[model samples]
Target: MKFLIVEDEESLRKSIAQYLAAAGNICDWASNYDQAYQKISIYSYDCILLDLTLPDGDGILLLKYLKKLNKNDGVLVISARNSLNQKIEGLSLGADDYLIKPFHLSELYARIMAIVRRRNYNGNNVVKYNELEIDTSNKEVKVNERLVYLTKKEFDLLLYFVSNKNKVISKSAAVEHIWGDDADMADSLDFIYTHIKNVRKKLTEAGCKEYFHSVYGVGYKFTDR
Candidate 1:
């Protein structure tokens, strides 16, 4: 999953980013409100770690802006403010979860996983399609009750396809979601084709049907039909 860390504290931001990265997640950091706003305007994130107090503006306002863009991105507010009113206001303003300062990184990771599952997969840690079962919490994929080893990118690719089942997902959208702002640096989207091919091969080898389809001049779709 892709995450945006909007914390002004340099050490904390780096620590959080490193932790999430180690867990096979792509993370981007923003030191202040302006940087956060700029990043949000350009790239879409699966989840955001936002600090309520920033050098330029309040995080609540930024949260409102995020909602305004119809992103529906999961947000976990991390703040030093532990007042009841602050927590209430942040939750009421569409924050998915809240974590007070001085918390363990493990707890934060758990919260993030919970929120991501809730937002994208309807709170189910396990996502099932036919004989294929994906345990999002464990990052495990199984076919017919047998474990199937998948590279991190391949796993993420499959999850992305399943999440948007039956919809035609553009190559550009996939690139941005998978690679984020770095997509701009790519010379071509040839890499996506390679990943898709590998994912399809793995599933087929596991006795799964071809659910992924190319859309001619458009993009790719995941459909039973």
Candidate 2:
């Protein structure tokens, strides 16, 4: 899963990012509220680890702004404050969970998985679409009981398609979601076509029916034939 870690503490932020990366998660760091705001406005994350105290502004205010924007991004508030009021307030402001400072990295990982499961898969560890199954915990994909090999980007792209099945996804949206804001430097979306082509080829070779459809002038959609 993709995550954004918002914390002013350099050591803590790096620690969280490294630990989560080791566990097969893509993590981005934001040192302060402004950075966090910029990241949030530009990209969509599976989950966000928010530090209540930042160099520029209160994390609670950011939480409020996220809610105001109607962004349903899952959030976990990681703060030094352990007061009942703070916890209650954070939850009320739309945080999915809270983690106090000085906590174990393992616990943080568990909390993130829990929140992601609840938010994306309805607390299920696996995401299934027709004959295909995605083991989120193991980052494995299977089609018709046979394991399908996939690169990280391919897996992420497939998951995104599955999650938004039947919806048209523009090339720009696919690039931004899979490659982030840096995709603007690319000369064209030919690379995106390449990725989609490979993903479709792999799935087809695995004896699966075509579920990914190119929308010609528009984009692509995942739909069962």
Count clashes in each candidate, considering only residues at least 3 apart in sequence or on different chains.
Answer: 0, 0
Root-mean-square deviation per candidate: 1.5, 1.6
Q: Evaluated with lDDT, which candidate comes out highest?
A: 1
Model 1 residue 135 lDDT score: 92
Given candidate 1, what's the lDDT at residue 177? 85
- The digit string of per-residue lDDT tens for model 2 on 82-146 reads 89999999999999999999999999999998998898888999999989999988889898988
Question: Candidates' lDDT values, in order?
Answer: 0.90, 0.89
Q: Please give the lDDT score at residue 153 for candidate 2.
A: 90
Tens-place lDDT digits, model 1, residues 1-225: 899999999999999999999999989889999999999888877899999999999999998898789887899999999999999989988899999999999999999999998898888999999888999879999889888889988998899889889899888888878887688899998789899999999888988889989998777998888
Off by over 4 Å in 1: none
